[model samples]
Target: MFFLQMSGFPGSGKSTLAREIAKFTKAVIIDHDIVKTGLLEGLELEGQDKNIDPKRAGGVAYHIEWSLVDFYLSQGHSVILDSPCLYDVIVENGTTLAEKHSAKYKYVECVLNDIYELNNRLKNRERMITQIGPVDIPEERWQEVINRAKKPTHLECLKVDTSQHVDDYIGDVLLYIDK
Candidate 1:
């Protein structure tokens, strides 16, 4: 079994690739968007979501996602966590979880370098409440996130150029995991 951690910008197809990976491997997907959106909606009904900052919600959602991953791993199931790899804490937590469960830790980074294409994807995609609709973040912050996206240096990281169809590199990705 494997614990695959997906990393990318919002419009870079993390979820889509996660779905494809899960389909082929029967891994359970814990999508951050689904978790975060559910969190915001539940908190919204309680009138507490307005003041819920992204960082706070992200922390909570990640804790919940990690818990689920741990549970699934304990049950001898592979898991695919669909979230941006923006922080070192995320990578550390995933690595720890994988080690604990004796599963291979796989990291895949989706890249869409063209700003125009990224903006187009962001605009055309069906968005969750927590997802950005466009490239509204300040340019420097945007560049920072791109720069911050990373994988553990010691492990093999699969960088998929998502400007092309996923099918093109999916087989190689599967092989990478299988090896």
Candidate 2:
């Protein structure tokens, strides 16, 4: 079994590429947005009057995500973990989890250098209940997100610029995992 983790900013096409790769590899996907949205929906269903705290929801979602990863890995299944993975800790934790399960770990980082294209994609996204919902990141905030994103270091990872065709990199990723 292999474990694939996707890291990127919001409009960088992480989820799209994750779905394509999952289809090709027959892997289960554990998406952060989906988990967080489910948590939010549970709160709403519980009749909680207060607005959900994103930080708390995110914490619980991550816990669930990791638990699912552990379950799938133990069952000898391949998994595609989809998330922004903006921090170093997230990347490190994923790597550690794969190691613990003795699964091939592959990290794919999607990036779009063209801010204009990224902004357009972000603006055109439709709201979905299954997703964390569309967030409008202004130019300045987008720049900040880019500045804060930490690329994985000292790891054999694939970096693809999503501005181009992401499918073009699937073969390369497969080859990397096979290695």
> Against the true structure, whose TM-score is highest?
1
Residue lDDT tens for model 2, 134-156? 45667666657655656557778
lDDT of 1 by residue, 63-126 (tens): 9999999999999999999998888989999999999999999999988876778899999998
TM-score of each: 0.93, 0.86
Model 2 residue 22 CA deviation in Å? 1.0
Model 2 global lDDT (CA atoms, 0 to 1): 0.80
CA lDDT scores, all candidates in order: 0.90, 0.80
Clash totals, every prediction = 0, 0
lDDT of 1 at 144: 68
Reference-based lDDT, residue 136, model 1: 65
